[model samples]
Each structure stands twice: as structure tokens, then as C-alpha cells.
Target: MSLPDELYNAKFAEYIDSMKIMYLVDDRFKMICDDYCISKVNAEKFRQKIERDFQHQLKHENLSKELEEEILIYIMKNI
Candidate 1:
């Protein structure tokens, strides 16, 4: 039988942090572009790509639903 290593969680936490930051940046960038009247090619496709990435991160990172909700709330509040 093998036991989980406590220290291993630190790396996973960092990965989650990175994913959260990327999601935040992507969301903010899209809003900023909209405000600036910047037209992107195939913008819906790009949005879908980012959405898929964020969903994958949430699922694979194993972050709690509450935490994910809070992160999104924070982003919405600030931007």
C-alpha cells in the first residue's frame, strides 16, 4: 500500500494558481479588447478555446467548486 505525500500538494496548488491566473488574464484581455474596439479574427473560436482551457484546468487541478466559484466572483468584481 502507498500513502499520499503531503508535500506533493504544494506543486498541485501552484498549478492551480497558474491556471487561475491564466483564466483571469484571458477574461480581462477579452473585456479590454472589447472596450478598445479591437476586432479579433474568429473571436468566438478564441473564446471557446479559453473556456475549454479553463474547464480543463478546473477539472484536472481538482480544485473545489467553492474555490472556483470564489475565484470567478473575484474576477467579476474587479473586471
Candidate 2:
């Protein structure tokens, strides 16, 4: 199933944030984020952009259970 653009963007953003945190402390995490389309500079930019765009309470909900499961498996395999 395809996700709405907004949902996909939000999920990608959340994943980026998690990766940034990990990247700051772990080299492996940095590698994973880079592999997944987020560079160190890009991750920082994403954080700033998210904060600015979502001034109010921003929540990310993964409605696609199958997609989520698939992503988890993919991440696990890659990591």
C-alpha cells in the first residue's frame, strides 16, 4: 500500500531525526543514515526545517503497519 505524501514525509523525517541522534554518538548510526538518504549536513537541515515548519505540536503516526514492519526489517538487515 502506498502512503499519502504527508505521511511518508513525516515518517521519513522521524527516521531522519532518530538517525541524527544516533549518528552524533555512533559511527555505525552515521553510516546507516547516510545509506538511507540523509547526510550529516542534511540531517541538521532537516531538524531545523521540521522545527520551523511544525511550530505547534507535531505528531508522527505510522498508520501503515505493513510498511512499518517492512522498514523495521530493512533497517535491521542493513544495520
Candidate 3:
């Protein structure tokens, strides 16, 4: 995902938004966000990123139901 200065700057916001949404739906997301001092005003920018990511991953990953559940657990643990 590396790029030239302007492109990187542009995409950085998207990636941050993605991470913010990842935290948003997560059960522990609020606690983690507060720990990092992220404000709701900024966090709201991530509202759709998680659903987008889920759709993308679901379309591309093609995992079995069990594997999908496991992957979700792994993500929850690491985040």
C-alpha cells in the first residue's frame, strides 16, 4: 500500500477510517478507543468501513463457516 507522498497521504485517511470501524463494532472497541483518546467526532468517520471490509473479505476469502468464526475470534483477540 505504499505510494508517493500525495497518494499515501490520501490513502492514510482511508486506512485509519478502516481501523476505526474495526474497533467500532467490536465489543471492546470503546474501551480501547478511550484508552487511545480517540474522540467520537473522528470515530464517526469510520461508520461504514467495517461493513465494507466484511463484504470485501466475504467475497474474497471464501472461508467455511467454521473458519470464518475462527478468523473473527482471532481478529477480536488481537484487536
Best-matching candidate per lDDT: 2
RMSD of each: 24.5, 23.3, 20.1
Q: If both were scored by lDDT, which would come out higher, candidate 2 or candidate 3?
A: 2
Question: Which ranking of candidates, highest lDDT first?
Answer: 2, 3, 1
Record all residue pairs in model 2 with backbone atoms less than 3 Å apart, i.e. clashing: none
Q: Relative to the true structure, how large is the alpha-carbon lDDT of every model?
A: 0.58, 0.59, 0.59
TM for candidate 3 is: 0.25
Which sections of candidate 2 miss by over 4 Å? 1-8, 12-18, 38-79
CA deviation > 4 Å runs, candidate 1:
1-41, 63-79
Lowest lDDT 10-residue stretch of candidate 3: 1-10
lDDT of 3 by residue, 1-79 (tens): 2222222244356676565565566647545555544444345557667778889898777667768899999999999
By TM-score rank, best first, the candidates go 1, 2, 3
Model 1 pairs whose backbones collide: none
Runs of candidate 3 with Cα error greater than 4 angstroms are 1-38, 63-79
**Candidate 2 lowest-lDDT run of ten:** 1-10
Candidate 2 has a TM-score of 0.28
